[model samples]
Structure formats: structure tokens, C-alpha cells
Target: MAASPAKKRILVGQSGGPTAAINSSLAGVVAGAREAGAETVGMRYGIQGYLAGRTVALGEALPDDDALALLRRTPSSWLGSCRFKLPALDAPEAEGFFADAFAKLEADGFDAVLYIGGNDSMDTIAKLGAWGARMGSPIRFIGVPKTIDDDLVGIDHTPGYGSAARFVATAVSEVARDADVYDLKSVTFVEIMGRDAGWLAGSACLAGPDLVLLPEVTLDEDALIERISVLLEHQNTVVVAMSEGVRGADGHLIAEKTVAAGTGVDEFGHLAQLSGPSRYLAGVAKARLGVKTRAVELSTLQRCASHCASEVDLDEAFELGRRGVSAALAGESVRMCTLTRTGDEPYAAEYGTVDVLEVANKVKPVPREWICADGMGVTDDFRRYVAPLAGTLPQQLKGL
Candidate 1:
């Protein structure tokens, strides 16, 4: 007779930044693992905690449908999150670190691991898989994408992006109306979040900003002032949307001048980008352009605004989680679950997998073609590309 397929113990964790739909993905992983006849453990605060031997008995913590349902709607990282970057398996310290981590997993009877996060989380997966192979361990690792920045590679778009984009669209439109409340010609600068990619900031285009600056292109301050001045001559209010990481022609962050000193770097070696470009521009417009100016920082509100979450985004997030777990249980490792867009007209996405190494530490920026020639607005093609994902653009205020 053929040997029986091996039973497995699966562990899941959340890492990096959280989003409105991240918990939905966790719930999906839990439910899918249970259905696959696998024992499940929740690594509290992700792999960082996993190494420290922190974990929760998921079956005991979220035992039923009601608990899982509540988890899906709850915003932020359900089990918690971390930004810890693992060193390569070939590093001098690797053997000692992997020994402890592998010992913990073995003691806990975990044979499969699922990491839900964006870029850095994938890096963890890739490194763990390398360690597993080197040690001849049977443990498998998989990555699930999650980020409001939408910079994760090997996917059409990420789970948290659509909902965050929806929030950006509505919030910008609402702010635009708020800025129009005065008789004086005013310039409003709306600051958006995107450390290395401009997808999140670009979503504000749907809200009708006179200027939409992406991180892909360096900011032209003179051009920006010139544009705003021209807009103010004809319009009472002009709103501009820009990314946090927008650089100058000299390849320096505009935030470098305005963000206070002593901001430290994260584990990923990226400067902990502070919020100040909008305020800086507001001051500049006041001094140079001679217009009333204001700045609005979207901040963490963008990622955790679950009330404004998109049903489409939540659904996809859940599906991706299930698919990632399913792939792992079927004996895949070092792979990331991805959503491949098969058709644009019908707007469909199919589940697929890409090597985690290809995705780890990689950033996907907005396509240059999607950005307009003038670099101030996005093209009609861009609208169609993200339209299905971004639901219910804020409507104009009705009636006087």
C-alpha cells in the first residue's frame, strides 16, 4: 500500500504594517487550515515573536464562526506585527539563530509556516526557507501580501490597497470641499503615504487634485509653484496631492528639510520617513506664491479606517490568505500567493504563486505610462485600471 500523506501543524503570523483587511486574511488562513485537517498556531507578533517563543493557540483563541467573523472586520494586525529583518541564511550568526527558531517550531510541532505581510515579511519567508533547506528540515514557508503602500511585487495589487485607496479618494474629495469654504484664493496640500512607491499617493487622482506627484518622479518645486499660481488665477481653491517620499531633482527627499532631525532608520535600513513635505510646501506657497495655504497629513488613518474598507479588498484579502495556506498544505515552500489579473474588462483576478525570493526586498512602483506626460495628473487609462478596485468615488455635494 502507498504511504499515507503526512499530517501537518501550521503556524501563521502577521508582520510589518497593518491594514484594515489584514485580519480578514488571518481569519481565512485559520479557517482554511482547519478545513485542511491541520493543527494551527498563531505566532504572536509574527516571526520576531515566534523566535522569542511567543505564540497563541489559534483554535483556542478564535474557536468558532462568530470569533472569526469579528476578526475579519477588526482593523489592524490581529495577532500583532513587527518590522524585524532576518539576516541571510549564510550569515555568520545564522546557524545559532536558526537553531533556536527551528527548536521552537519543532517543540511546538509546526511543520508549515505562513507569514502575512509585505516586502520585509517575504524576506523572512525566503530566509527561513533557506535555513530549512540547509538544515534538512521539513518545514515549509509561504508569504501573503499586505500593505497600504501597494508596493509588494509579483501581484496585480495588494490586499490592503483598494480599501486604503478608497479612503484616500473619499478623504481627499471631502478635504477639497472643506478647503473651498473661504472667499480667499487658497492652496491645499494633501500629504499621502508611500515610502518608495507612489501607488497610495497616486490614488488621490480620483479626487481631482490639480497636481498629483509620485515618488517615481522628483518634485519640481518651481513647476509646482507655477502650476498652483496659474490655478489660483482662475480658481478660488487648488488642491495638490503628493507622496511622502517625493524627491527633488537633486535626488534628496523633500521631507529631509522639513522633518525634524534624529528620526531613526527601521530594521529594513529605510529612513523612517516623517511627515512634513505638505507643511513645508504650505509655508513656501504662503511666502512665495502669496496664497493662503494649508496641509493635511493622512497619517495612520489611511491604513486603519476599517469603516471605509472596500468589500472587494476584504474579499480578495481573505481569498489570498486561503490560497496561501492551501498552497503550503499542498507542499509548496518559499512562494508568495499573488493575484494575477486575467481580464481587464470583466475585472477578474486569479490566484497564483511566485517565488518568495523574487518578491522579497522588491518594490513595485507605479508605471510611467499610467502617469500623465505633464506629471501632474494620471491618464484615463490609469482610471480604468484602478476603477474596479476603488469603489464609490465621492460624489459632488448635492443641492444648495
Candidate 2:
């Protein structure tokens, strides 16, 4: 569809999880909107907040380049984020929420909506675009990728992943260095964020970890223990990296054992699978293996450590945001701007659009071939792929 003759007023929001480069995307969207001669408004806390009648004009909020520049470097979502999953459209009761969503757009005079988020966020864009089309509304919807999970399909990697992966790698390497300083043998378990994909967890290999557990591979307690035991004989310290979503032989989240009712779920029906893997494994190692253990959960630190944010990730995230605005202005709907890897050495990325439905709510787990045959670590092939993505920064930990 070609853009209409009339100028558009755009509404932008952030949804699902937060990331270090999320703000960079926001800056791009705002700048792109201004450059395209469109008025841009922001949902205070994403669409969920907008439905409650909360919003602000972006031009007034970020009136100058100085403010926009600050936002581009800021970590986390400046517009706030929500995981409020829009119910399936077929549900009769959902009509009211849908009605309100449409009302919000009409009331605010928004002709285009650009949503910055991850997999579930794309689902929201797909739904809203479909709803608008069915209602004969000309409102355009575009999704800008943002996630540390890096599970979204139709792209080489979602924005916010490279920087997070860098942080995780740095944390693993630094934590390992700290653990080894003690004379007594010990095992330090570090848990990273990944619901089902192991990209973040797998990056630990760059830091020289003894083992890397990805959600794509089940957590084999026996094998993990055996490997640690063998390593302890010669090494004073062993560091094991695992994804938070790694499951045990029984097929339950390793975090499940640490909680009575299972890690309570969030708005997306995802396990709030917090630091359980590290704590549980550390507990087990001490009780069964008779070795000192410490569980280190990098948790939010990995996502908010902007000091280590990858320049490559920030640049791509900003460009993706800008591309989303351009796509919507071109009258595109139900489409997402994606990053296609063009080169590895030069680390080039090109923006393209894809049908939102095709990639919505999809999970692209770390490839099995990328995992070592033993399933305890990543293969050399994985290193070759990720090495260039994480920018050149001193990987050295400042303290400890």
C-alpha cells in the first residue's frame, strides 16, 4: 500500500521485555518520524498504558537533539514497557479491549503505530494490524525488534542481543577469574537469560567457561556433575554457564526445584524463571559433590550494563527503529523490520521487512549443530558466528 496524501501522526510504544539498546530504537523512531514530517506521540507505558488514556506528544517531550541523543544511549525502555498480552481476536470478550485500542488510536489521531519489542511484541503488531484492516482503519502497524533473548525468527539477531551477550561473556569470564583465586577447589554456576534459546548462555564459551548449558539442550545433572568432577581434579575453579530455562531430566525448569509452585509466570505466561538454575546447581554441587559452590545470577545486570553495550548493537537497533518508521510511512502494515546479516568481518546488517504473522510468537532455539556434541558447551562454529557481533571492548572486568 502506498502512503496516503495526508500527513500521518504516529504513536510508538515499547512492549514485552526491556534491553540496553531499546532506547536507541526509540531515538531512531522519533528522529525518523520528525524527518518524515510526521507528528509522533508515545504511549506512556506501551499500548496497555495508552488504553488507560495515558500518552504524551514526543515532540514536546524530546524537543531537541540533546534529549534524543541522551535517550539513544539510555538503557531500558524510556517509554516504559508492558507484557500485557492482547487476547486472541476470536474471543468475544476481547472485543472491548480491541475497541478501546482502536479508540485510543482514533482519539489521538494516530495513522501509524510503531511497536518496539521482541517475539510477543510482534504478535501484538500482527493482531493490531489485522484488526485495523478488518475495521477498514488506515492505521499502520510496524514492529521494531528488541530483545536480549534473540529468539525472534526472520532475522539474524534481534537488537539488544549483542550487547547483552557481550555482558554475559564478560560476567562469565570475570566471575571465573574471581572463583579461581581461592586455593580450595570450587564450582561457580552463572545463569543467563534465555527462555528457550541459548544464544546468551552459549556466548559464555567466549569467556573460556568449562561448560555452557543452553535451553535448546536439556540440563543433564549427571553429565554436568561428572564434567565438573573431572575438571576439579586439575583445576582450582570451574565455571558453568546455564540458561535460566534449562530443564532437568524430568522436563521441569531447573528453577522449578528452587520454587514450590514453580517460578511464578509473568503476563506473557513465561516462567519468571529467575536465578534458580545457579542457586539450585550450586546447592547440589555442595551437597552431592562436596565442593564449595557459589551461584551468580547476572540477572538484570546483563541487560542494563550500558557501559558494555556493543556499538554494533546500538547502531543496528537505531537503524531498525528508523526503518520501521519509514516502512509505516510507506503504508506498510503487519510487517516487521528485520536485520539480515550481510557480512561477518565487517559486521554489516541490512534492514528488510517481513510479514509479521510469519515470525510472531516463534522461537528460534540455538541450532543443535552450534552446540557441542556433548551438549555441555557450544562448538567452534558458534564462536565463528558470534565473535564479530560483540564489538571490540576491553573484555576485562574492572573489579574482582
Candidate 3:
């Protein structure tokens, strides 16, 4: 379908959490829009910014050469970001708010909008697209994927997850090497990201099969302590990687146990949740068995280290952004730009569109069958599923 002949104008925004490869997607939007003769503008700080009338001309904010170069090197959301969840379309105020927003967009001459974000962000696109269609607004809405959580459904893996996983594998390997140097009896527990899914934690398996721990596996704390105890007994140094979301058979986050004991809450009305299993589990190891323990939390750095991005991930992110523009121009609405794996041996991906409703707010978890029965590691099948997504090793140093 060809886009209407009216002069092309676009608005792009970044929403949700920041990621290492987010800028690549942003760059893709700008460059592709330009090549397609669309005048592009950026909504500062996502939809919240757009609602508040904060924006900048993309050409003026980021000149062509600079934007393209920055896209490949930049980490985090370059246009800023927001976590605001729009009211559901059925809500009484929804219609009026969207009507006002779309009116503002039309007044500003924007015929298309691209939102770069994860799950919740996609939902925003879906709602706006639907509303635009119903009200006969000419604006087209598209979603560009970005998330370290890798939980977005209908996409093989979110862009930032690969870079974050690379960081995890690198950090764990370095920590393991450091622990090995200390002959004194000690246990080092490293916690990794994976709020609900074990993708990031599972990436530690790339460092080595021996150091892997995943959230999908229900842990045996007693057995874990015993295994560490045995390893300490012989080597005097032990290192283990655990997911922050890991749970024991009783169904409690190790961090939750610590918070319950009075670590208290933050301003967000939530407990000061740490990113890794290390701190809580380390306390358990020391108090119950008297072993000297240390915990390392690999938190935000995992998502902000563009210096360590996988080339494949970066390229795919940019391509997704470009395809998003093309799709929107062709009258595709309520769709998320996605990459589907076509092969694993010699990794290949094909760009496509998936209904935003299929992905919005839904999580894709690591398969239970991919986890080992003992609940401490991933099976070979898991390796096959993820290894292809990680793609071939890059020439850049790992874990930058």
C-alpha cells in the first residue's frame, strides 16, 4: 500500500528502559526517514514529552553524519525516555487525551509516529494506532524493539539483551578468574539480570557451563550450599552465577527473603531489590555454614555498555528501525518491527511485523525443558535456542 501523497512528516520517541543498542534504532529511524524523504522530529522523553509539547527537529538536533556515527557507538536512549503507561483506551479520559494529542500531532504536521521501547511501549503504539484508525487520523504508529529483559513476545530476542548478555558472560568470567587467585577459602556469588525470565542469567552459560545458574530452575538452597561447601573444601575458592529472579522450591526470591528481614523499601513503594542473587544468598552461605562470602551485582552497566554491543544485535536493531518506517509509510498500523531467526548454524534473521497486541505486556519465558533437572544449569537444548540469537562472536573484545 502506498502512503498518502501528503508531504511525509514523522515523530519518533524513546519509551521504557534504556538499552545499549537503543541509539542504533533511533539512528535507523532518522536515517531511513530522511532517505525516504520524510521530515523527522523527535519527542523528548517519550510520550510524556510529546504530551507536554517537548520536541526537537531531528535534522537540527542530530546532523546526518553525527547521528549515523553516534547510532553505532551510543548506548542508552539518546532522545531521553519515560516509563509512563497510558490509560487504557476504554478509560473515560482516554478518548479525550488521545484526541488532544493527535490534534497536537496534526497541528505539528506529523503523519507518522515511531515509538522505540519494550513491552509496555508496544501497547502504547497499539492503542494509538487503533485510535487513529477509528477516528480517521492519518498518523501511523510503529514500535521498534529495545529491552535487556528479552521477555517481549513474538520477537526472537530484544536488541539490548544480546549486549547485556555479553556483559554478563564477561563479568562472570572475570569474577571467576579473580576468585581463583584467592587461595583463602571463599565463595563469590554473582547476581545477574532477568526480572522474570532467565535469559540474561542463562547467558552466563556462554562464559562456561560450570558457572551457569538460571531462574527457570527451582534451586535447592541446601544442595547449593553443600555443593559450594564441597568445592571450597577442595579448591579453597568458588564462584557461582545466580539470577536476581531465582527462586527456591518454596517459591520465594532470595532477595525477597532479605527484604522481608528489613532491608526496607525505596521511593517507588517497592523493596530495594538488588539485581542479583548474590547478596541474599551470600548472607545465607555465611550465616548457615560459616564460609567467607562476597556478592557482586551486575546491574545497569549491563544495559548501558554500548562499548560491548554485539555487532549482530546492533545491526538488527538498526534494521528493525528502518523497517518500522517502511511499514508505517505503507499503512501498516498497530505493528511491532521484529527479527525472526531463519537459521542458526550460519545465523540469519529476516525482518517482519507482528501484531502489537500479540506482544504488548506479554512475557516469553525460558522454556522449562531447557533447564537442567537439578535446577542449577541449562540443558544443551537451551544452548541451541540462545546461541543462534547471540550469533557468531564479534571481533570486538567481549564484556567491554
Candidate 4:
């Protein structure tokens, strides 16, 4: 009798930042590969770890449904992550690196390799896929999207964004209620995570912040101070949700303008620090308006709050992971899985694929139309766009 087809082997890695739903996507890949009678291996800490020869047999590690269920609920990258940037395919440094990587991948008999990450990670996939094509390698390379920024191009929204957005909205709402307790004129600036785009900060509008500052719109410093002054004239407390990357019309990050020295950049060239914007804005308000001002930087809390995770987000993340694996197994390469929004009322999404080259190193910013004319708030259309992904938030009690 003819022997059955040999089991296809796949290698997957998580890179860049961690999110509440990133592990769920990893679990989905494992489940999908197992169902197809394939072997699934995970890089211990992305491509860098693989080069260091570290990997885990995921199927053997989590052999049952219960383990996968736990993995889905777990926040952060299950396989660890890194920010190691790869050299360009034609760069002098890439020759040895690409040769060694492809040799190792082929030596281990991986039929396909996948990366789960955001923009920078997609860049890795694009480079690897291009290199593989040039060398006529058989192993396919694919990208699975994961980011709290919600700035990945070619997808309606990313998996981690839903959970992060929900957390931001809930946290902002709670903070707003707390700020209202005393009858003192106060302004609280809640800084959220979002570098090039303002999706996360804009999400604070779901909780009805008095103002939402986004990087997409240049900061009018005088106007912001005046707006807060006017807001305090009518109310005892004013809450503003601002993106950490908010910049001035001069096209420089407000955080950089706040501090004298530089913090340096990451391997991917993004600012190593985007935390000072809210504090700077708060200090400015306190000094100028003479009101009680406080800055609250959500920091890392926004990305991995599994308790506030949106069901829709987790479900979509898992489904996308599965679809990505299927696409790679079907001989597709240099592609990233995408989600096309089909319906808004019931909130339906369809899984698809987009060329990884098209998505890599690109940022999808919040649409100008979504921001209010004054650039201080989001429109109802923005709410309609994000509310579904964020799912239902808790209703809080208001005291008179």
C-alpha cells in the first residue's frame, strides 16, 4: 500500500509587542495545524530565538483542548517576542544571515513559516518571503496580524485592538467618574498607547471623554489650553484622553519637545519613549490655568488586560490565525491574513489575504473624517465603527 502523505511541518513566531489576544492567535494556529495532521513548532522568542536555536513543539506542549483554552485566556506572547530587525535582502549584512536562516529552515523540513505581529514584524515576513523567492526556497512565509495600535494596513482592525480599546474606554470611564467626586476645578489627562496612529486614544471617546487628542491631528497647544479653560468654566472636572504620540504642527512629537535630552530609538527606529506627552500637557495646564491637573499614563496596562478582553476580538484573532495557516499550507506565500468588514449592524467580518509587501512598514491612521472638526473629539461615525469591535462595556453608577 502507498504510504500516506508526510505530515507538513510549520514554524510560527510572535514578535513586536504583546497583547491580550496574541496568545489566542497562537493557540488557533496550533489547533488548525493539528487538525490538518501537521506538526507545529514555535520559536521561543521570534526569529532571533530561532537563530539561537530555540523552539518548542506546540502540539506536544499543549496536547488537549483544555491547554488551548487556557492559552487563549492568557495574555502576552506565548512564544515570547522580540524587536530584532532584519537587514534588507540586498544589504551586505543580509547574505550570511539569509543563507543561514534558509539553510536552517530547510534543514528542519518546515513546509511553511508564519509570523504573528504588527508593522515591524510584517517587514520581517516581507523580507524573508522575498529572499526565499529569490533563492527558489519551497517554504512559504506568511504574516498573522496582532497589535493593540489598530494601525495595521489592509485589515478592518487588528485582534489585540478590541481588547485594548475596551480597556481604555472602561478605564477612562472609571477615571472620569472618580474625577467628578469633588467639586474642584480639575483637568485629568489620560495618556493612551498609539504611536503613529490615534486609534487607541480615540477609543476613549466610547466612554465620553470631554476631549480626545490624537496624533492624526496636530496639537494646537494654545487652543487645547483655551478649550480646557472653557470646559472648566462650565464643569468642575474635565477629562482628556490623549495619544502618547500627539505632535505639534511642526511635526515633532510633543514628548520630545517636553524633554531636553533624547531617549534614542529602537531597532525599528520608533521613539523609545512616548510617555511624557500627557504629563507635559498636564503640567502646562496646571501652570497656565492654575487648576488641579493630573496625568495618568495607562502604560503597559492597556495591552494585556485579559479581564476586559472583547469576545469578538478573541474570536476574530483565533479565526485569523487559523486562516493564515490554511493559506500558507495552500501554497500561498508573502501574504498576511486580512479581515474585511461585511456588515455593521450585526458586526460581521470575513477573513481574507493581502500581500505582505503591501502591509509591511505601513501605518493606518484614523481617518480625518472620523475626527470631529475641532480635532478634540471623535464623530458618531467613529463610535459606530469601533463600538462593535469593543463589544459591550459595563454600565457604571453615577452619584449626584
Write down the TM-score of every candidate.
0.96, 0.95, 0.91, 0.98
lDDT of 3 by residue, 197-280 (tens): 888888877766355667667778889888788776677777777788888778777667655455665432334565536787
- After TM-score superposition, the amount by which residue 320's alpha carbon in candidate 4 deviates from its true location, in angstroms, is 0.6
Put down candidate 4 lDDT per residue, 143-196, tens digits, no spaces.
999999999999999999999999999999999988989979999999999999
**Candidate 2, residues 1-400: lDDT per residue as tens digits?**
9876776798999987788899999999999988999888899888888888888889999998999989988998898988888888898777897888888688878889999999888989999998898899999999998899888999999889889988888888888888988799899999899877888888777787999998887777888898899998898898999898888888887877786564478887776655587898898899978989999988889887888788888888888999899999898999999988888777777789999999998998888999988889999888877777777647355343
- Show pairs that collide, candidate 3: 191-276
Order of models, best TM-score first: 4, 1, 2, 3
Which scores higher on lDDT, 1 or 3?
Answer: 1
Every model: Cα RMSD to truth: 1.9, 2.8, 3.5, 1.2
The alpha-carbon deviation from the true structure for residue 69 of candidate 1, after best TM-score superposition, in angstroms, is 1.5
lDDT of each: 0.88, 0.87, 0.81, 0.93
Candidate 3 lDDT (Cα, whole model)? 0.81
Worst 10 residues of 3 by lDDT: 267-276
* Regions of model 3 farther than 4 Å from truth: 1-5, 209-211, 260-276, 388-400
Shift in Å, residue 33, candidate 3? 0.6
